[model samples]
Target: MTNHTPPIIGLAGGIGSGKSTITKCFNNLGVQSVDADDVARLVVQPNSDCLNKIYQRYGEDILMNDGSLDRRSLRTIIFNRPEERTWLEALTHPAIKEEITSQLSKLTSKYALLVHPLLFETHQNAICQLVVAIDVPKEIQIQRVISRDNTDQESVEKIISTQLSNSERIHRANLILENTGNIDEMNAKVFKLHQNILELISC
Candidate 1:
C-alpha cells in the first residue's frame, strides 16, 4: 500500500442504512475504505487495554465465555443509560480514531472512504474533503436492522433515536445517497456517486 495519505471521503448513515453495502460497492471500484465500526471492534478485542478497562468498569458479566466482549449485553446497558454510553464513548473513541488514522494512512487509493456512522457526531467529518450521507426512510432502517440483527423493533428504534435525524444528516452532508430501493438500484447509485466523488476530488 502507498504511504500517501489520500483525501478522505466520509460516509455517514443511521443504523442499518446500508453503509456497509455502499462501502462494498466503493471497494469494488478499487476505493479502499476505513470503517470506524470495524476499528471500534478492534480496539476492544479481548486482552486489549480498552477491553481490560471495560471489564474493570462493567465486570466479567460483560464478557463472553471465550473472554471476548459481549457486545449485545453491553449495548443494552449503554443504550438504557446515557451516562454509561458517554463513559464508554469516552473510553473508546480516541483509540478508535487512532486506529482509523493509521489504516487510512496506508491506503493506495486516490481517495479513501472513511465509513463512520458517527462521522459528524464525533467531528470526524473535519478530516474529510467530502462527506456522503446515506438517506433511508426511518421505517426501512428499522426493518432492515430487525431483519439483519434479529433484533426487536423497539431496540432498533432506540438505536435510531440516538442517531442524527435523516434530515439533519442530509443537511450536513456534502452529498446524499438514497437507499430505499433494491440492491441493483443501490449499486447503480453507488457507482454514479463514486464517479462523481472522483471527479470532485480531482478538481
Candidate 2:
C-alpha cells in the first residue's frame, strides 16, 4: 500500500437493492472493497470470541449442527425483539468496525469501496470520502429479497422498513445509481459511476 491512503467510497443501499452486484462491477474495474456484511460474518466464526459470547447469550440453539451461527434463526429473533437487536449490535459493531478498518487499510486501489447496508445508519459515512446510494423501487426490493433469500414478503418488507427510505438515502448520498433494470444495465451504470468517482477524486 502507498503511504497516502486511498479515499474510501461508501456504498449504501437497502436490502436487495443490488449492492453486491454493484460491488462486483467495481471489483471488475480493479477497485478493492471491504464489505461490512462479510466482516460481520468473520467476527462470529465458530471459535471466535464474538461467536462464543453469542452462543453463551443465545445458547446452542442458535448454532447450526456444523457449529456455525444459524443466521436465519438469529435474524428472526432480533427482528422480533428490538432489545435483543440492540444488544447484538452493541456486542458486534465495534469488532466489525475494527476488522473493516484493518481490511480497508490493506487495499491498494485508487479508491476503496466500503460496501455497507447501513452505511448511514451506523454513522460509517463519516469515514467515507463519498457515498453512492443504490436506489430501487420498493416493490422491486421486496420481490428481489424474497426471491433471493427464500423468505416471505412480510419478512422482506420488515427488513426494508428498518432501512432508510430510497428518497432519504438519495438525499444523503453524493451519487445515486438506480437499479430498476437488468444486470447488464446495472453493470454499465456501475462502470460509469466508477469512472465518475475517479474523476471526482482526481480533481
Best by TM-score: 1
Candidate 1 residue pairs that clash: none
Residue 54 lDDT in candidate 2: 88
User: Any idea what lDDT model 2 has?
Assistant: 0.92
- Candidate 1's C-alpha runs over 4 A off are 1-3
lDDT of 2 by residue, 1-203 (tens): 23565899999999999889889989999999999999999999989999999899999889999999999989999999999989999999999988998889889899999999999988999999999998899999989888999999999888888889999999999999999888899889888998999999999
- Residue range 1-203, candidate 1, lDDT tens digits: 24479989999998999988889889998999999999999999989999999999999899999999999999999999999999999999999998998899988888999999888999999999999999989999998899999999999999999989999999999999999888899889989999999999999
- lDDT, candidates in the order shown: 0.93, 0.92
- RMSD in angstroms, all models? 1.5, 1.4
| Residue pairs in clash, model 2 | none
Q: How many residue-pair clashes does candidate 2 contain?
A: 0
TM-score of each predicted structure versus truth: 0.97, 0.96
